[model samples]
Each structure stands twice: as structure tokens, then as C-alpha cells.
Target: MSKRWIGLVVVLWVTACSPIDPKLKQYLVEGERLYVLHCSNCHQRDGQGLRRVYPPLAGSDYLKENLPRVICSMKYGLQGEIIVNGIMYNQAMPGVPSLTELELAEIATYLYNSWGTQTGLIDARRIGPLLDSCARPRPRR
Candidate 1:
């Protein structure tokens, strides 16, 4: 094969491998909106929260490794010890159960995706189960 053909093949291969999902993009946009309405005040518009009161979401380890826990907290709020960035905080994370399941999912997706490396969507599929589990905890976390 000619060098020109090889270059064309490489370009096509790259394009095919990294197809951006339109739905995923759409969810991200909506998630931003959800974050604003529900989380911005405490976490701030830039995901930076008030000192000792709210928790920063930017570069948050809890947001990444403990994704499910984040979802649980969002669904039912936190009442005990919590860490944000490198700081430890103990505050009442007010519940937002009034938010629809979709809204919760969107916010979850936004926070999860915003931190360091992007993550898979925390959509209705994962959220439905998590919410169900957290809202009425048979065994507390």
C-alpha cells in the first residue's frame, strides 16, 4: 500500500475508535444544569464549596473511588463524617429527595464526570438501584 493510503487508513481508524456519543454529550449538558440548581450553592458554581460547611467537588477522591457512596449521599444526604479534598468535615448534607430521579442522576453524572478522569455515566440504570437502596436503608452505610 502507498504512504497516502496508509495515512488515510490511520485517519479513518482513529475517527471510528473515538466516536463521541450524542446522548452522552446531551446528558452532560443536562447534568450541568442539574448541578447548578441543586448543588452550586453548597459546592459553588465551580464545584468549590464553602470552607468547613460545604465540600469541594473538584478533584474530590470521594467523587471518584466512592461513586456509589456519593450517589447514596445525594439521595439521602450525609449526617456524619465526610472528607472533601484533603479536609475532613462533619456536617448535615441536606436531602434533596424532592428532586426527581432523573435530576439526581444528572447531578451524579455531572459530578462523577467533572472530577480528574472522566467516568462512565451515572444514569437511571445505576441510579435507580442506588436510590432505591439508599432512600430506605435496611442496613445503613
Candidate 2:
């Protein structure tokens, strides 16, 4: 085989071996945009969050352990105490009730994958039923 054909096969193999799926890439792109619009103000552009007030999403234990709650909290808001990365945060986070289930999934996908977590696409289909089961009303300030 010619050198050009060998190079083409090598490129194809490398591309096939890539871990990032096209669907995951699309989710990540959409999620990043949604995160910027809805979450970045509090979470910060780097996911570091505001000091002491807004909890950091990067490698957050709460997020890892409480995927359902995190999803619910985005739409219904959170008030009370939660521990993240060994630190306790008691601040209230208002939900974006206007966000659709698909939008929430995109945001969740972004949050789960960005910073340090490698969790892939959070599908909108999964989010719909979860949102229905949230049950709790949005907290009153």
C-alpha cells in the first residue's frame, strides 16, 4: 500500500477510536450555550461559582450523588443546606421555571460533563419523567 493510503487508514482508526460521540458533542455544545445563558452568572464561566454564596459545580459531590435533585432544583429551585466537596452551602438557588425539559437536559449535560466530571449526554427523554416526579413546588423567597 502507498504511504498516502497508510496515512488514511491511520486517520480513520484514530477517528474511530475517539471517545467523543457525535451526539455527546452536540449535547455538550448545546449545554454549554444553555449553561452560559442560565447558569454562568452564578456558577461562573469556569464553573468555580461565586465565593461562599454560590456553590461550585466543578467536581461537586452533591451533583455526583444527587443527579435527580440537581435536575429538579434547576426547574424548581433549591433552598436549605447542601454539602459539596466537604463544604456546606445554605444559600437558596432560584430555579428557571421557564426552561423546558429538553433545555433542562442540555443544562444537566453541560453541568455533568464540564469542569471535571466526564458524565456524558443527559437525554431529554430522561428529564421529562424526572421533572414530573419532582412533586415539590418552587420555593418562595
* TM-score, per-candidate, Cα-based: 0.76, 0.83
Q: What overall lDDT, based on C-alpha atoms, would model 2 receive against the true structure?
A: 0.87
Task: List, residue by residue over 70-141, the lDDT tens digit for candidate 1.
Answer: 877776777878776678888788767677777777777778778565876767677777766654544546
Scored by CA lDDT, what does every candidate get?
0.77, 0.87
CA RMSD, predictions in order? 5.1, 3.4
Worst 10 residues of 1 by lDDT: 131-140
Candidate 1: give the clashing pairs: none
Best by TM-score: 2
lDDT of 1 at 2: 100
What is the RMSD, in Å, between candidate 2 and the native fold over all Cα?
3.4
